[model samples]
Target: MASIVFAPADLVVATSDDIKVRFAGADLAAELPAHVQAPPGAVGVRVMVSGVRGPETMQRDSGFESARLAWYQQRQDGGPAREGSAPTMPGMLVLERVGALLRDDVGTECPSVAGQVGGDGTEWKGSWTYLPHPPEAARTL
Candidate 1:
């Protein structure tokens, strides 16, 4: 199964209806297994997060805060192409909700996201877990 990691900086918590995530391998379908392929026929995709600290512990604990990101898979028509051309890749990823990173209760809204094949396409099912980055140590110069 192909895996992608989203660092704290790579996640974007936009407005209520928008959330952006920039991680490696989003377009690595060719390299991933059939389930995780970027093509139309692929298996389910799972998205999750780690290193979540409760809102009350945000100030007391030196760990990262809680955060969530939800999404659904969809199929879009690629339109007509040359007979010898490649099939159009699906271009639909519907976000259900984005947790507030700044809030103590980010986990309240964000749920684990799992995406299955959009239509009759085959799929390569895999996990997409998002864990918090380790804090950098201070330099003692």
Candidate 2:
């Protein structure tokens, strides 16, 4: 449950392979948590996004679907192309990363970050973080 808050200008971009990030230049890859499992699934990616979104803001109504769309659109347009929309908030997104399986011990307060693809298959839960360009920054995703 550790957390890190990055300045609005620090993150440069993110892609399917890795996130290109830094205080300014593209010199570093933002580190993922140790609990992260490989072969990351789409639903898990969404959880990490929620983590990056942090717990302070309103949970996106469409979950990460809408945010993902907006982010990709920003990248495709070469920069922030939206006109006069609500200002984007700046803060570290609080993504849920599971450390282990909770199984039948799941509790009422249990986070959605756990679970796995069982023999019959199951959906993974959680997301990662990214500093989406604030409206003022208007930079690429």
Candidate 3:
């Protein structure tokens, strides 16, 4: 019998025609399009997000240094529990994109960049970023 091994949940990422993501690895059946399939490849147009709580800190010395430092610390030391009353629900952004499938086996590990998506003070709406090497950059499907 062929043995099956599951990859780490966090290691499992999702790629579609519009947005490519490194999520907690959700059930793709519901998210997959009518004609899409498993082992999907990169799309020309790629997107990613970081910092789900409020907005992400921009790199450089301009500002938001403390917030960025805090996020980095949390990742290294494990997320610290907030002392005061935690806000109901976290800062989040919902992205919409097109879906396309890749024929070849793109490795499990995806390369991503941090980007900000909003101007709001309470949320960091940025994409985690995906880069398409082949046919390149696709619009929403």
Please report the candidate that would top TM-score against the real structure: 3
TM-score of 1: 0.18
lDDT by residue for model 1 over 33-82, one digit each (tens)? 44432445432323432222234323322221111011111112333332
TM-score ranking from best candidate downward: 3, 2, 1
Worst 10 residues of 1 by lDDT: 65-74
lDDT of 3 by residue, 1-141 (tens): 111133343442443322333332111112222242334652322333323221222321124445555656666665763332322212232233322232223333333322234344523333433233322232112
lDDT of candidate 2 vs native?
Answer: 0.29
For model 3 the local lDDT of residue 123 reads: 38
Q: What lDDT would candidate 3 get against the real structure?
A: 0.32
Cα-based lDDT for every prediction: 0.26, 0.29, 0.32
1 versus 3: better TM-score goes to = 3
The alpha-carbon deviation from the true structure for residue 89 of candidate 2, after best TM-score superposition, in angstroms, is: 16
lDDT of 2 by residue, 30-111 (tens): 3334465434432221122111222322243245446657776876776764543432222222111222221122221212
Off by over 4 Å in 2: 1-63, 80-97, 101-141
